[model samples]
Target chain A: MGRYFFHTRDGHREIDEVGLDLPDDRTAGLEAVRYGGSLLADDPHILRHDQGLRVECVDDAGKLLYTLLVTSVDAKENLATFATEKD
Target chain B: MFDRDMAPPGMAIFLAKLLSHSLLSTEDQAAIAALPHQTRRLEPNDYILREGDRSDICPVLRSGFAYRQKITEGGGREIVSIKIPGDPLDFQSMYLRTVDHNLQALTAVELTVIMISDFERLVQARPAIARAVMVDILIEASIGREWLLNNGRRNALARLAHLFCELHYRLLDTGSGGLDIHKMPLTQEQLADVLGLTPVHVNRTLKALERTGAIARDGRGIRIADLQSLIGTAEFSDLYLHRDQP
Candidate 1:
């Protein structure tokens, strides 16, 4: 098993000093995605204005393994343009 | 007659836990000490009891920590309760036919395993011990109810703070008189499972608690920096623990 750190950013950067032990990089990638989902679930307002949340997974040697990003797009302007095109 | 000095290792702590909840007479204590039992040790992640397993022995945790958890169909685990040293590992087996949840060691654990028949005989012969056992089970259920409220209603910060406060009080009640506020036993992943949150959220909440001066980081573990502040943050009450004897 290897130790992996998940550093996060959501308008603020929080460096993870204590890392989790997992079997491989694939598992670390899944963990990063889970972390990003949890962040968004806890506070969906971060995605209100197209702002994004990021989870960066790094190994014990400070090597990056995976990055999971969660964001949302405002589709109201796109819908208006589509309506004009239809007209 | 069983000599107190010759009692099995970890027996004193188990007796002390019962005595804390109910007054056990000298005879009752002696009967408990005289019960036939064997000591067994387990490493971390070792399963003491698995779901749906039938066993005739009830194990009392003599030292180290364990937890009860349930797994969902999707393979997600939810930890229901944390067991400390001196806690009875399987009181339900005395009356129930099958185990309901998985019990695993969170650290290197030592357990005093007693036959269910022997325990049942002792409980029938002694009324005070029976009362003590009942109180212990009731208190565990009460803690479960509080955990439900903690996970369903409280925020992450309050949930973490409340858990630490509960642990502090429980360790103090063990009567061991050696409560180490620094060496917390649960990992972030374990804490997340307990609180119904992810490890990332657990980490963030721990940092927030540190900022409030309720706890401080100590390497991989955390120290209870300010108990009063933590209690205030959790809005914790000891009524659920039922430490005071009636």
Candidate 2:
């Protein structure tokens, strides 16, 4: 098992000082996804502000392992523009 | 013939805990103090007992912290209870065949292990001691019910606040140097498991709590800045702890 840090950015950077021990990069990637999901669930407003949520998983030796990102787009605005162009 | 003054470090704490729960006679206290026991030290994450394990021994937390947890098949873990210094680790083993949950060290801990046969014999011989043990077990069950409500109903902020309040009161009851909130043992991940929240949510809720001036962060340690504010936030009630009993 190796130690993995899950640093997050959602309009602000939060560095994880105490990393979790996991088996490999694959597991770390899964953990990052779970962490990002939790962040999004806690506050979905960040996506509404056009700011993407990101979780960066790094190894103990300062190596970047994986990154999980979540973002949203205003599809309704795009649909409205498409309707106007068709007319 | 056991002398209270000559009792070992852990034995005194154990006796004090029982005495707080029930009115044990002098002979009963002496019997407990004289019980044959061994002291063991364990590091964090060490398993004291696992589900389905049958043991003839009972452990008492001499110092530091321990917790009981249940794990799901999907690798999810939920910490059901936190044990503090002087808390008996396995009273259930005396009557039950096997453990139902995992007991693990939450921090570096010292345990006083006694044979279940010996404990059972002493309880049978001393009605007061048996009553004390029963009260202790019932109190634990009461706390468990409150935890159910805390996890199932309370919001994230109230959930975390309620936990802090409970821990503070429990430590105070232990008479084990009270709680130094700055030196709180559980990590954020552990806290998440205890409160039924994720680490990200724990972090965010902590910041929200800090903004209320209920807690202050100094590097890795957190201190209780305004306990009244915290109590208000949690809507805490200590009736479940049963500190007033006996």
lDDT of each: 0.86, 0.86
Write the residue-wise lDDT of candidate 1 on B104-173 in tens digits.
Answer: 9999999999899999999998888888889989999999999999998887889999999898889888
How many steric overlaps does candidate 2 have? 0
For residues A17-75, write the lDDT of model 2, one tens digit per residue.
76787899898889888877766655568666556888899999989988888888788
In the range A1-87, model 1's lDDT, one tens digit per residue, is 999999987777889987888899999999898877766765677565444787899999999988887777668988999999999
lDDT of 2 by residue, B1-246 (tens): 656667777798998787667787778888899899999999999999999999899999998899999999998999999999899999989999989999999999999999999999998988888899899999999999999999887878898989988888887776765444435678888999998886756876788798999888887787678889999999999999998978
Worst 10 residues of 2 chain B by lDDT: B174-183
Error of 1 at B205 (Å): 2.1
Residue pair clashes in candidate 1: none
DockQ score for candidate 2:
0.26
Q: List ranges where model 2 is wrong by over 4 Å.
A: A1-87, B1-6
Give, for candidate 2 chain A, the lowest lDDT window spanning 10 residues: A41-50
Give the Cα error of residue A3 in candidate 1, in Å: 6.0
C-alpha RMSD of each candidate structure in angstroms: 4.3, 3.9
Inter-residue clash pairs, candidate 2: none
